[model samples]
Target: MAVPVESEAPGGRDVVGAVLKACMLLGQFSADRPVWTLNDLTTASGMNKTTVFRLMATLVQAGWVNRTDEGAYRVAMPVFEIGSAALAKLDIRSAAKPFMSDLATTFGNTAYLMVPAEQGAVCIDLLEGRNSLVVAGINVGSVMPYHAAAGPIVMLAHSKELRDRWIKPGLPAITEQTITDVNLLVEHLDEIEDAGYSLSVSDYLPGVAAVAAPILGSDGAVLASISVGGRAEEFEGAALAAKIEKVCAAGARITRIVRAMPRA
Candidate 1:
């Protein structure tokens, strides 16, 4: 019979190593390797086959892991459910939705809420305006390149560590308008940080123009970015200035809400 490895606390409360071992097993799964065989997990976890099997069985019973027909293990729906529940608890999205909708409607352009992820930015939410011509086909869950697009660039400009890590020796060009020169890109990032927002034309894709501003946390760190994107013609001259003003105002409102909320 398998037993949880336990240690006594100061008050004699038990600390179970088996639960931590099970968490370690789950932590092995990632975007690169989402599934694992019994032997694979056993080797990666450095736990014996019997212990791994017992832990896997317990996890399967709890609906945290699913055993495939091929005898492999993968994260189950319970994990996604837990993640979704946590996301639902975040007030930023809820607080920003009204302003995003109003901004999109007022400007007749797409408004996006982008958050940093793995050297890139992911669109967490979006509201499409009444414009018939779509500049980009991006939606929620779309990953934007860190080196391109207004939202991602603004995020990178604020996050020094992520910028240094992601910006390498050679910058890849997605479009002809994309900034391939590292020095030029660095200069642009500096301008963005000073101006408190980013405005770009055809930087990520042809015929697209965008303006973005950072949403700051209570500690004045970049929490995320809000961007408005549309056709190139709509982003020129006085129209561009109007868009910048509205986008910055919306960003400021969202930042204030984020700062007021208690950290989770």
Candidate 2:
């Protein structure tokens, strides 16, 4: 979890108050404006100088933010750890995409690269199946909600942290078929975990069904995931399992390749 930025000593508010205000102030900066002066934060947050300086001092002390030579403030290196850890896990996605592409071409199933972050599996990259109808709805950078989408479900089933963190409450209802009930969803997720993959039919976008397998690391950690998706009507029951072998095979191959290579 990120420590929300805030500062004390401006109005001499309580420690909690300072933390909250600092967080609110830091939230004001982003990719476009990564650095800011005391006046800049004050204007953006509508807070006074006393508040901004105190807050920035706390941030600078905590290593969450830094001061530039020109006297501007910017976010520091802690954020990189989140991305780096995820990348170390998702290296399988880097290795397996091309192999999955071959399977997509062979089976005409759209292949997906699913990596968990911020309580969902982000579709970092994708390989379209040849028929165009193989996997129709999702695209690159599309997010798979924990309940409905096969990628997140499979990844979550493989990750204790993900299952406990994401599959709890407020599961977004992407479609009428989306599962929001915790108990019912848990039963299904349990089955996915036992089976070593996750499967879903129209739980996310309508008319789409997907099968996913967990991509693991060399140390037996659930790294990322891979999925095969097609139209729900055309691919159900027997048809779905028919493709699972190749999907799992591709996923396993991808994981081995990723685990063998040095972290980039």
Candidate 3:
């Protein structure tokens, strides 16, 4: 699991605090104010002059920031490379969006598109249905655990590497229904793989349910997942089955679209 980014220093861990401060310093640069000197950065960020200098020097060394002969700093090529990489990942989101919209409209629930991340899975896009009460705490850019939610579980079921990394002892529980037991979760992932979809109830969030399926690459590798989620009470036997079928179909369609895209 990726260590959580903390704003404050934890016991015997100052790296997180340093990372946070560096990010804060970087935030001061934008199109409007693209370049900054040590004095400007320290004053604008309200950080110690020595700290700002150290951070700037580190960023320059790391190729994330560039320093001019005049001692002004600007974001560097690596930053643009990172941005381009993120935009490339959004291609899958574009391919899956129409199907997600259809799922949301037909089911009167929320449809989510999630892509695998270093830590787990990230919700890249979400379309809300006509349901009166929207499920809370989940929005675009929300990072979900690989063992809990239907989307992440679908991801875990399809990827052996993710399963090996995430399905270990003492998996954190987000709700009472969350499967923290390593053996049981392993069995559950096998079932999900055999079924080619996942049905989750109140696992990640209270009173919420979701059905998800994997969107596979041309080589059959799991690329991402698509899911429909709403109130737990609304998901029952036949209704849940129909949702599973729809979500799986959506996943298949998106896989085709992604495959048809021109390769970079």
TM-score for each predicted model, relative to the true structure: 0.64, 0.61, 0.65
For candidate 2, lDDT tens digit of each residue in 1-264? 122233343444444676668778777765557888888787777776786888899889999888999988998898546545655656555677687787678767677887878846788778777764644447787776767778888877777777767766776688898889988888888898888777788888788888888888877777788888877764666766677777787777677567656566
Candidate 3 has a TM-score of: 0.65
Clashes of each: 0, 5, 0
Error of 2 at 29 (Å): 53
Task: Tell me the whole-model lDDT of each prediction, alpha carbons only.
Answer: 0.83, 0.75, 0.85
lDDT of 1 at 246: 88
Model 1 residue 170 CA deviation in Å: 1.3
**lDDT of model 3, residue 243:** 92
